[model samples]
Target: MHKFHLSIAALAGASVIALAAPVQAQDTAAQAPDAANSDIIVTAQRKQEKVTEVPISITVANQAQLERQQVNTMNDLNRIAPSLEIQQAPGQNTGGGGSIRGIGTQTFSAGAVASVGVVVDQVSQGNANISDLFDVSRIEVLKGPQGTLFGLTTSAGVINITTNAPDFHAFSARVRGELSDAGTAGSKFGNQVLQGVVNLPLASNAAIRVSGVANMRQGVNRNLTTGDLNDNDRYGVRARLLWEPADKLTVNLIGDYARARAENGGDFFTFIKTSTGVGSEIANCGLVAREGNQNYCTSQSYVGHTENYGGSLQIDYQAEPFTLTSITALRRSTETGYSAASNVFRADPLALQVANGPVNRHLSLFTQEFRISSPSDQFFEYTAGAFYSRQKQTRDPETLSVMLTLFPGMTIPLVDPATTGAGANDKIVDESLAFFGQGTFHLSPGLRLIAGGRYTTDRLSLDRYNYATAVASNTVLNVGNFSWKLGAQYDLARNAMVYATASRGFKGGQIATPSAPAVPFVVLPEIPTAYEAGLKTTLFGGWVADLSLFYQKIKDFQAQQCTVDSNSVISCVQRNIDGVKSRGAEINFFGKVFDGLSLNTGFIYAKATYPTGFVGTDGTVIGGTQLAYAPKYKFTLSGEYEVPVTSRFNGFLAVDTVWKSRIRYEANSRSETTFRPHWLVGGRIGVRTEDDRYSLSVFGRNLFNVHEPSLIQSDFPFGGAANIGAIYGPQSFRQVGLSFDAKF
Candidate 1:
């Protein structure tokens, strides 16, 4: 399947390039009607310009494109971006992890941080907890390493989201709703959302704008044994206000609050059967059932709630030669969960030992940045900035489990043991500060030079206290790095530029877990450097294309593990691998073939391999092998067309498809049953008023009903010489829905 997908992608690329040949020649003939042309302006480079002008690898999904494609979240955007992937946690559905450029953390450990960074309205949402989206303008995805401009968290590039700001124009409002079904047995869901934006002209010199969103979704799936809802229920609300008192300076203050209640059945791999004499699947083994008198599977559940709030203030001043901007943002989140214990499978006969637990996490983040930029029209332009961020996180998790025994002809009552249960508490504080600058110098009429550098310092302090084992630990680490970038761009024509760059990225150091009940490990972080060359071009006058080839080397990559002491208390640990290398090439193109017709396509080919041998849990060497979840190929294709239906109405149609090559999800030396390949195709059809004030859209996603496992793990719980294989998340299948939007 992996080979087949790659072949298809290669063929498609060849076909599209062939089709572009004549289109490029006809560009001059179709150059008229500039206003009605389907050209887009983007701010991906921090300045508004034609998409074809930037000499970087980027993909833009504008507001109209998002709405037409029914994209409401980052997960939805993943379908059209080949190098990106998202996955939910083990026991809870509310939180998840994301990866880009084949670098991400897949563990459920509380201390783990994401490799990818998310930005909203220029404020950093770097943590894994800030994944929600609401009231957004557009999303800009920059592929490859983005260290120079995006800082430490963006080792795998950046996802910059610009939210819809307060409209200075009169009152505007919008409302939308959707209903969906999982297609699996006992699954159904629905969502309702209301949003509005209003602008008030206070006197002649001031204006105020307010925007708010309210959303709720019903849960689906009920636990067969507990007769309780298994997966469902989500809702949140956000509001922001903007105040502008002067023409040259503007102050924007924003605050939002969100809360949700949901249940989780962690990674529902097929259920286990109880005894051979069992009457039914539910009556087999309490929560663990025997499949064929030998194999068994355990069931787990979780109920969680999360609340978040944040506010930011921005001040901008515009001058003749330079502009100064200052932004300050602060945010906090609280999360709590109650879950049933996991890993209850046994080959021998035993009654289920029930374990119920709760975990809580509190997080706070603060950031301040000041920037000064030169005017855009000069022969030499520059941007210099100072950035700072501080984060604090506290976590407490408790679990209680009891052992149970039963006889064939006797009834066993479930009882809690007198053994003292164990609990763990952790507090983490991290701070980062950087001084960065970027400059563009015109060397000649057609050649330009660009260079950027950032000096960054990261400090972390961690304290852990275990109540069950009566052990406590504290660690502190500080690291510094100077990352720089140099690039040269040569314009081949009026709207084409070819550039090459050398850049570097770093991930911070962290405390590690001990193996074999010995000394604790404190591993240093990883540093990845990339050498890339790319071409940015405009063809057919309406088409924008970008292609890049990159090679990256990472030293000391961080990974996860766990260790137990003599007292049977477990401690989650982090470790560092010696070295790894990744090399890849990406191609992306978007164009308007004719009036009201547009198409977009992208492809990525990557390979990640370790040079030296690394030891696995069983002390086997894994060398010259591929890393986990790093596929060889991934591609995306989407097209949309708009047609006039009448004098007052228009019709729209679109098709989107994604294909992913097979990936190994486990350590290369340990297991082999970890690859999965899948493809998804979807479409949308809608009708809208000519003025774009009102519209109706009906869409179906994952229409092909491809069920592809997003994650796989082997040797998960190496207890007593048994290996467990766990898989999570396949595409949810076809979902059909209708939406309505209007401006009032």
Candidate 2:
């Protein structure tokens, strides 16, 4: 039987889809003819440029569009952006599993850098809490390798986020309140959210804007063992100040602090039964019943906490023939979690503990960048900059493993400890310095040539400590590399352009965490070469379509190799895989059909394949064809339709749909490791006054209540006989909520 979750949101969405008739323009979109073609300003190339004019594949999601999509955090963008995919990889932080165009960081080590650059306000968010997307001006998704302009972390791409600037001449205030399924039986987070912003005009040249959010929502997964909801509470606030003393100089100061506390380290719904069967998945394990967020655990939950704070100062001075800019930032974050808890299962009558222990990580990073650029619109435009950053890992993770009781010779012979947990005390310091420059030469009135290069050097040191043995060790690593790119663009017409580019990107090596008397593992740098061609055109008056074809090859791919002993104890080390290749094409379109309707669409067809060469624990070479957790195709659509119903009231509806191909969950391309493809539909409809001061709406997502597990893998030593895997897909259920917004 196939049916959607029968909720209020579905009833509203059905009416909207019927009336809007194929569209994604947000409700707040201006009722103007150029709604779809409204030029979105972006900083993809380290400079402000129209999305259609830039020589890169980009996706822009503004505030109005974001609200219509019901975007709450970074992962929410997956529904609207084709290039961004948030996979829930095991043993990684929240943002670590994010991938762009099938390439992303999938490691449990702090030494490894992300393939996508998570940048906020021109500052890198190494370990910062960037979940809060409210008050943001726009989020730009730049596809393909961008190492030359962004940091080495951007071998795949970048998520550039810009916040709203303070208004210098106006005092403003706004508030948003959301109440969704608040305490609805076993399906409630008491999900009440209150967000407010205020801007004050200080002096004649300085203005400050501040915003804060208090979300009383948490995990909705109810644990049968403990009768408690696995909850993760998040709260944060940020402030920004803008000062313009003169016409030639501008200064912006920004600061933010955020913290989150999660129950059982956010493992509440992660280890539910894999199948939707009527009985237990494992024989004698009566704890197993149904699937989805419902879970049955033998052990109780634990607490996981995280705190993040950061600030940045940006100064821009325009002088002579060139503009000078500098940005400096400092950030720190700390996270704690108990990894091996609450997932233990014991088919036997006795419920002894299998493993228990706490692991913690701390980070402090500082970065500075200075650049000089020729004025825009020049025949010979150029920009040069130097970047420096230092990151310190003060407290590395610690682990303690307990022995597992093995029940051998029985019909089912898998270890099921009903038991007890690691303490590795390692610290690391990494410093990097780089010099980069790019030039765009207008060869003719309609032709341009582009070239850029960056030279980077890194020095790292580590301190390893073994408390049980009272011994300490030190290790050091140093490396240098260069990234460069060359490209050309031809103006086919006033609003259309064609471009081609070839580039080599570099990501620094990794020095694994300390593991005692043994030497620390060091994985060398990852080098990637990319070739791309693209077309950006505007036709049918205001329809803008952008297309790109790209092929990227990565060498010395970094990977985490782990092994589980007979005791079911897992240990991991960083390793370098042979290579991987990803080739794909993307299309993004936005246009206005009429004053009341607008359309936006995004699509991607990428094949990220891993070659056949991974060294197994047994020293045998094992490889897979497709990249784990990466889908070959993805399509998304969004739009808005607004029609005035009365002299003082307006009716509007917005809708979005996302469809993704099936994906493999692990390194091996076995049938059991694959999952079926799925599609999602979401939308919101509401009415507002013509003054645009107040508005209300009904919103919902995953309306079908589709049970799609973001990850599926064999719990090898636990699931006797068939090793019938475990399931975990956070926020997979249907959600319907009411939201209200007001402005003054």
Candidate 3:
């Protein structure tokens, strides 16, 4: 079937399932109803507000929903939010990124800036690290441009995470642990997690909170050489302090540290022979192995380790009708890893012996911001802010080694003292300054107008040195840009609001490292303009629904291309495309269907394509093709039921299912690297004490053992005859687990 038709079928199926649930009559005799679908508070606009009151297309998940859904990491969010997708890069061990609304970074270069920004407690991070999700209170996903309010400029959207704050009048502690098995022979303790949090009142007006987590898991894939692959061992801790010296003055300090050491599931190859006379040297290897079977056959190991630490300070002061705030932060991250190159050379005789060397990277960043805002109750409320940030990154030297096994007992090195052990030392530094302001004017009692603008200046520098020849290259770039938003909103009724907005977002110009010395070193920035209209409504007293439609056009979209020269040396380059267009519609509904039953459903339909004149890396015309990782239709349906088991205990059950259409992994739209439509189901059943202090539950994820590939890559055209294979990462297998929680 055509891809478009498949998308339509999937959407139809999801709609039927969502609307067919029998709506049970409300039971007045039931106990206190479940509050899971109650009004949720979100900070999408840099201020607290009910999610139903926000004009943007936003999704908010609280602690209760997160626990019931078993969402432990950022990657798990795709199951609930259909507009987002996350995947690991094909060949790299420490380079993976995500996309929002069909727009994101296509390359894994350290110098490439992300279209989506991730913020934690008002502090922006350079990368989308999953460790920051530990012990989070709530997560809010905002769709569309957000440059006018946030310190970081994002063309796609923003993810805002808020952690629990210290309470001066409370002393509490909580602990939770989980243990799971993969339901396969030779697989023991597939997953384990232990987490704890403590809150204490140090003085009359001062308080402190601390949180820690330890997570470990065994691999889903078994390596023929090594025992297991894709294992995870991670630990993290966070501390926060709050002090209120006066009624109008408040200060907060936060620090966090996280470390991970594990073996990454590097790319596994499946051979594809283009020529018919190539003998039995190539065979069809499924992207994902069947149940109870290993997928990859390799001789070398792929391992990675990472360390991250950060701290931030915030101060707020209230003066009459205005408030002033300041935030200062610093962070550092280091990663080291290596992946074998044998997967790309499956057709050669010495394919199993080649391997790439270790890769090391370090990043350090500092940021500061100051802001002032008028009270929200005023007729003309306004906010203004200034931001400054500096970042430095370094890539350590790397080495490539080849092993020769001529005669079992005798082997010699085929090495040239100088060029055989070549490496590159690269460094990048960036500094940015921006000033932004937003204001809302009440045109009338039921109508409002909003306008905002931001101006940013960025300075970037790059230095590269070759160890073999002592050759060096240096480049610098400076650019300035402006972005703005215009919006209007109207209150139609007591429980309905409609809004429309048009916004522009910008990304800084980048310094591209080209293989050819004659090419320029700089690629201009990309800008996107988006127009959106949305409606939010609360119906039937407890049912909330939202609908949004958006259209975006991006100019000078960045694209990466690779070519093989006459000497068979591959050279990759980055350039700007003419333009791209994306239009989509999102629908969300959440509320209590009956006294003890709640339902949450989300659906997304998007069509993202490139304009005419777009070219692929292998000289193929890719005009009118779908963007990478952009699916046409996606949907999620989740339902939960809560009932009283006893006077002091409550029993609850939750089940959720997610479905996504086929997605292309590369711009060329090759069929071999496309992820077909798939579905996943998860559920939990448990009982908890009436006081909510103690609980136990049994849960299962991927209950049907679906074999789907998360990412797929084809190296047939880029590597010529030497590399003609496909690599992919399969989804996790079925897992069943039990969890225990306690509070004091």
Candidate 4:
């Protein structure tokens, strides 16, 4: 609480200083020649607009910014965007999840759906994976519900990624490579990346573009028994074709494929307890090991791999007053892996080891959309669209094993056997259809009224079979809902605006895999109503600042719950909390403080809590507790300076830092699952050709070498032990690297 107050006070002071400074009576259109701090263009409203002119809270990162920040994957985005939080899924490294403003999904089951949606090239992704960042044009992060414009309805927000399109008038090629080493004892060349892109003009009206990336990195964690574990080797390729057969018509086709082969990072046990008889045996296991130790052990090699491929076709036609667009897309992905319950192994007194059965999953998705929009220059502008999507997923049967050193000679059968295999094969299918429309009415030259709405219907079905018991079950759900948004914006002056908005968002309900015959198999949907007010301004003709305050009320919040049986086997279920409330404030600024220098800063303060009737798997009341992975306060500061060393060369330096308050890993809020506050610092220095055809640079990440755990989980007691055990996710290590780029 003290930290939160301090952060707020600091922001208030900065705001006061910024407002009190002498104002320059200059037009924003004729600002100083600071190309590095120019106005950012965004498409948050499904149309092109200046960031400062948009009513909602948003962040934009262009290709230059992404390269400077070294944001290659989803996890790396948090360094620049503090409100976005990401974590690796339990027992897996190749797949993970993210949340915006405390709304997200933590379960990896086929029945679960993510509250946050990820969109690439107008197509929604079924699952979150390591995204390849080669040949990307821009990334836009929307901070509120976007149900009315996007095909997928997510309660949280959306991440919109737009890749570079082919250019018909030019032929060009580029190559970039990087080499990095983990700054830790016994660490090797940990990260090596190579990427290339080429564009060829087939004719005056047609062009093709191709891009590929190769990435290899050594895992920071090690296994004493199996040398180097959790290493990464991945490759991806993308191709795009653009054709303009007529002056008023355009078409684009895109295809991409990616594959990864790697091992998941070993888990670190933060806490362990056993029966009193094995006191010395438990004392020998250490809590932390940089390389590997007996405490973190794996008898069999753990491996994970994934293959993903997708394609999309888009068409657009320009009319005198309106534009028509159509998009069709299909994607498929497959993943397989093995994970151990405990990374540590012991042979003495109470030797205990457990491993998860093989995991296999296959998923496919298809979507289509059609839209029409009026020109923005009109007094009344509007857009209307219809969207359809279908998805199917399958999970194969899996098994689990538990062994104890004390009972090595004893062979138990049935319930207490060394291995238990689940014969259940699960399948899930989902289909959705929606129609949405939005319009803006200009009351005056500087004031506008905006209204939008969406009508959606969804059908979900699940099938499960248990091989051991020969029990089969099927469930189906049909849901329909309406979401709407209303807002008004007024320009206080030509360079400043203030807006207010009220909106409603919805997520479809889900079915739970029955742990037993008596438990319920369905959970209700979630709905959140939000109200917000914001200010966007261009100050001093060279600085841009945006501030927003929002409040939300959620009913029937869906959350994941788990049960532990007498044999210590865990089963998952989804439940609905009665009520939850979230409120927050955000402030952002980007501008040139002086010639040849630029600065970007942001701050977020959020409080997300369950208001009533929230219970945990352990039968503990969790009312008034914070949501999982939601921190109270977050801040980021970054700056860069560039100077012309000569007419043909330029030198630059950049640095950034981020701070986050304490956060709980789960809704239960157990002491062992809490993560303390941490800070990270990173920087870069480089020299490049003035024309930007070639460059060389050096960069360092996690400069302070902070070892903060990204995730933690508590396990039920095994072997009749009174105390429970806990597992910790791998922490990112500090690294330094050099990179070079060439263009032709």
Q: Give the lowest summed-lDDT range of ten residues in model 2.
A: 412-421
Q: Per-residue lDDT of 1-744 in model 2, one digit per residue for the tens?
A: 001122334334434433443322122223222234456567888888767788888887766677667666776778768878876533554344578788877776766677777889899876454765677777788887786777537777888888787876656666675666534422333355566677777988998989887655544555455555566567889999999999999999999998877665453323343333213333233455344534444455577777889999999999878899999999988877754242433223222224445657788889999999898788989889999988887664354444433334323213322211234567888889999988899999889999999999988787876554566778777989888989999999988999999988877778776333345778888888889999998766656788999998889877665444455544466777757888989998865546777677889999888776754443545454567667899999989898898999888898888888988666653455466788887777888778776788877666676656655544333332134344453346666777777665
TM agreement with the true structure for every prediction: 0.83, 0.87, 0.86, 0.87
lDDT of 3 by residue, 1-744 (tens): 132233335434533543453332221101112233455667888776677777788866666666677776666777767777665554221112556678776564556666777788999886525452566777777888888888764778887878878767656666666666444322222766667777777998998989887776655554543444456678889999999999999999999999886564343444432333222322332223222233344454567778889999999999878999999999898878853342334223332233345778788879899999899887898889999988888987665444444656665544222465455677988899999998899888889899999999999888888665667888888989999999998999878889999999987767775432342378778899999999998766766788999999988876665444442233456777767888989988776666678777889988888888776655678787788778888898777898999999999898878888887756664565566787888788999887676788987777776645554444432334333444433244576777777665
Those runs of model 3 whose alpha carbons end farther than 4 Å from true positions after fitting are 1-38, 90-96, 184-189, 264-294, 297-302, 337-354, 401-421, 514-520, 561-572, 591-595, 716-731
Off by over 4 Å in 4: 1-37, 90-96, 128-130, 183-189, 264-295, 337-350, 411-420, 514-520, 540-542, 562-565, 591-595, 616-620, 716-731
Per-residue lDDT tens digits for candidate 4, residues 406-511, read 4658743333222234446789888899999988998898999999999999998888876645678788989999999999999998879999999998877777
Task: Report the lDDT of model 3 for residue 688.
Answer: 87
Better candidate number, 2 or 3, judged by TM-score: 2
Model 1 poorest 10 in a row by lDDT: 23-32
RMSD (Å) of each candidate, 1 decimal: 9.5, 6.6, 8.9, 9.4
* 1-744 per-residue lDDT for model 1 (tens digits): 232234335434534543453321111112222224556566655555566666567887665566556665555767657777666544322123556667665554444455667777777764535545655666778765566666437776777777666544343344444334333222233334444444444545444545554444332233444544344334455555666676777777676666656555333332322223332433444443322111233345456676777878887788656888888988888878753233322212334344435768788889898888888778898788988988888877455554445655554433222224555567878889999888889888888888988888988877877655567888788888888878888989887788888887776666542322233345676777878888888767777788888888887776554332233233345666767777888888876656688777889987777567676544667776667667778898888889999999999998888888877655545443344567777777889888666677777767665545544333222231233333333244355666566544
Cα error of candidate 2 at position 251, Å: 0.5
